[model samples]
Target: MSYLEFLGQYGDRILSGTLVTVLLTVLSSVLAIAIALVTGLMRLSPNAVLRGIATVYIEIFRGTSLLVQLYWIFYVLPLFGVTLEKFTAGFVAVGMNLGAYGAELVRGAILSVPRGQWEAALALNMTPARRMIRVILPQAVLIMLPGWGNLLIELLKGTALVALIAVADLMFQVKQINGTTFLSAETFGTALIIYYVIARFMITPFMRWLERAMQRKLGRA
Candidate 1:
């Protein structure tokens, strides 16, 4: 059968899976950003207790594999009477695992701010919250934007793993099509192209825009 015919035949099923992938990416990314912001700031905190907690959380999540975490959440949790839906387990694991990695980016971005800025904020009697929210945070955003973009792209690709957990993501649909038609190359190739379009056309340009906006805000544009 022609590739076009194959595509037309199973397009709906594939589109459904793509929708799931898109939803997972959006949900996990927002959560990851929040987690990155908190843990990132906590990592730079002066309080040893807070820093230690943030450090431990990052280490635990980053050190472990995402697939293992997903399995633990979906399968093992049930052993303890804490069953979760497959989609929930998938997003939670992806968000948490990526959040740990993102926290490091946040830490580096914050620290990249010039020391003079922090000192000036202090001299001006700016509260700690004010310093971060008003001063350091803006500057840090320029640095963070690139790293955040990279993480978001990773999240987009990472959605493929959700299929393994029965979340019906793009990869799951591709596999289903392949099974029914025995056309592995066509199904997987189409999915790969779709992912590339999302990452290259959508995600990359958005990140560039964000970076430019942050730089303009800093008067560095």
Candidate 2:
């Protein structure tokens, strides 16, 4: 069959797969952002205990392979009587893994903020939480925007791994189509184009808009 005909036949399946991929990406990205912010702040906590906990989490997730983490969470966890649905396991694994990396980005960005900002907040009698929220994080977020954008793109590509957990993401659907039709070139090529389109047209644009918005908020635009 021609490419158009093939697409016509399987378009619904492709759409379903695309929707699943988008869902996984959005959910995982949200989780990763939250974890990064919390763990990154913990890394800078005055309490040694908090810093130690963050360090251990970062090391464990960053040092290990994500595939192993996925297997452990999805397959091996049942041994300990903890079971997560495939989609849950997939996003959790991906989010935690990426969050470890993003935490470092957050830490670095926060550190990059001028020391004067912290002192100025202190002079104003701002509490630690208030200082960070009002004075520090606003500046740090601009520094971290590019890094976060890159991480988000990586997260998008990484969604392919979810297919291994039977989450029915784009890659899973493409693989299934290829297996049945043996149309490696068409199936895989379509998937490649779709991913590129999503990244280029969706993620990239959103990131750019976010950067612009932040810049305007900070009066840099």
Candidate 3:
């Protein structure tokens, strides 16, 4: 079949899959950001216990393959009576794996803030929490925006792996269509274009706008 004919026949299915992909990416990104911030802060804590816990989490996730993590969450977890739906499993795995990496970015950005800033906060008798909330985080966020943007894109691409566990994401639907119709070129090509458009047009632009907004807030623009 021609590409047009293929799209016409399977457009609805592809659209549904695209929506699922977007939803999964959004959920995973939010979870990742939260995890990154918590773990990153823990890594900076003076308490050895907090630092140890953060270090273990970061190493375990970063050292392992994401695919294995997904499979373990979906397939192996049930063995221990800790079952999760396929979608939830995929979301958690992707969030956690990327969160580990993003944590390092968060830590580095926070550390990059000048020593004088911390000293100034101390001089003002600002509590640690207040210092981070009012002074350190604002500067660190600007520095971290570029790294977070890159991680967001990577996380978007990583959502494709959810297909292996039956999440019905873009890649899953593409595989299904290709299997049934045996039109590899048309179906897979269309899937590629759709993914490229979503990442290039949608995610990239939003991230750039966010960076600009943050810069303006910090008077750095």
Give each model's clash number.
Answer: 0, 0, 0
Error of 2 at 164 (Å): 0.6
Give the Cα RMSD of candidate 2: 0.8
lDDT, candidate 1, 1-221, per-residue tens: 99888878998888888889889999999888899999999999999999999999999998888888888888999999988899988998899889999999999999999999999999999999998999998888787888888899998887788899878999999998888888999999999998988899988999998888878877898
**Mind giving the per-residue lDDT tens digits that candidate 2 earns over 7-90?**
999888988999999999999999999999999999999999999999999999999988889989999998999999999999
User: Worst 10-residue stretch by lDDT in candidate 2?
Assistant: 153-162
Question: What are the per-residue Cα lDDT tens digits for candidate 3 across 1-221?
Answer: 77787888999999999999999999999999999999999999999999999999999999999999999999999999999999999999999999999999999999999999999999999999999999999999989988988898899889999999999999999999999989998888988998899889998899899999999998988
| Model 1 regions more than 4 Å off | none
TM-score of each: 0.96, 0.98, 0.98
- How far out, in Å, is residue 17 in model 1? 1.3
